[model samples]
Target: MIKKHLIYKKDKWNMLTVEVNGKTLILREISDQWGEECHTFLSRPAMMHWVEERFPKEQFEGSEEEWTAIMQAFKEV
Candidate 1:
């Protein structure tokens, strides 16, 4: 059986927990920014710099707001 639960951790983050059989998939909001400029100006080095300088994470990192802004500047297909 597959069960889905929608959970909100905060205003900018969410958790979608899905269970199938005995397996669980935790799809977190992790990062929200996934737009145009991100795909354009942000390279791996740039991203690493931004993540390191602005956001610190134990496991994950990056500026979700930047992603959002870039995404807003572009269109999703």
Candidate 2:
């Protein structure tokens, strides 16, 4: 299961922290943006296209299924 902690943002991106097992991820949403929390995942070939376009240097990790579930959970928020 993923555990989350809400974080306050002051002139910064809103943050949501999700921890699975012992791994922790900080998902950020820009101020004024709404939707699921933000987190990082290793970008796949197709995903890398956009990841690179927006965040060329962003780092990604985790299995394919793990990422899928994470995204789904974000949508639930």
Candidate 3:
């Protein structure tokens, strides 16, 4: 089975989707202006880098711990 979670959503133009299927995790950045982009991560570090690059902590809508928890969840998967 595949599960998808919306980790962050500021508006229609900016949102992040994390999709998990078995052992594969797919991160998708959905934007109306920039268009949709999909990234597949096989390692924790790569996933972290993509998160930091696409969604900076300073500009994130949630708390720092919330962001950390999101990453931690990814790490566990």
lDDT of 3 by residue, 1-77 (tens): 98887776779888877888877779888888879999898766777787778557788887989778766655565
The TM-score of predicted model 1 comes to 0.23
Model 2 residue pairs with clashes: 27-38, 42-60, 42-61
User: Which candidate order results from sorting by lDDT in descending order?
Assistant: 3, 2, 1
Task: Write model 2 residue lDDT over 1-77, tens digit each, in one string.
Answer: 66554332335454444333334444454544675555554423333343345333234354666455545454443
Q: What is the lDDT, from 0 to 100, of the residue 73 in candidate 1?
A: 25
lDDT of 1 at 26: 27
The alpha-carbon deviation from the true structure for residue 17 of candidate 1, after best TM-score superposition, in angstroms, is 3.8
Model 2 score (lDDT): 0.44
The best candidate in terms of lDDT: 3
Q: Could you give me the TM-score of model 2 versus the true structure?
A: 0.27
Give all candidate RMSDs, comma-separated.
Answer: 13.6, 11.8, 3.3
How many residue pairs collide in each prediction?
Answer: 5, 3, 0
Task: Report lDDT (Cα) of residue 50, candidate 2.
Answer: 38
The prediction achieving the highest TM-score against the true structure is 3
State which candidate, 1 or 2, has the greater lDDT.
2
TM-score versus the correct structure, for each prediction: 0.23, 0.27, 0.63
Whole-model lDDT, model 1: 0.33
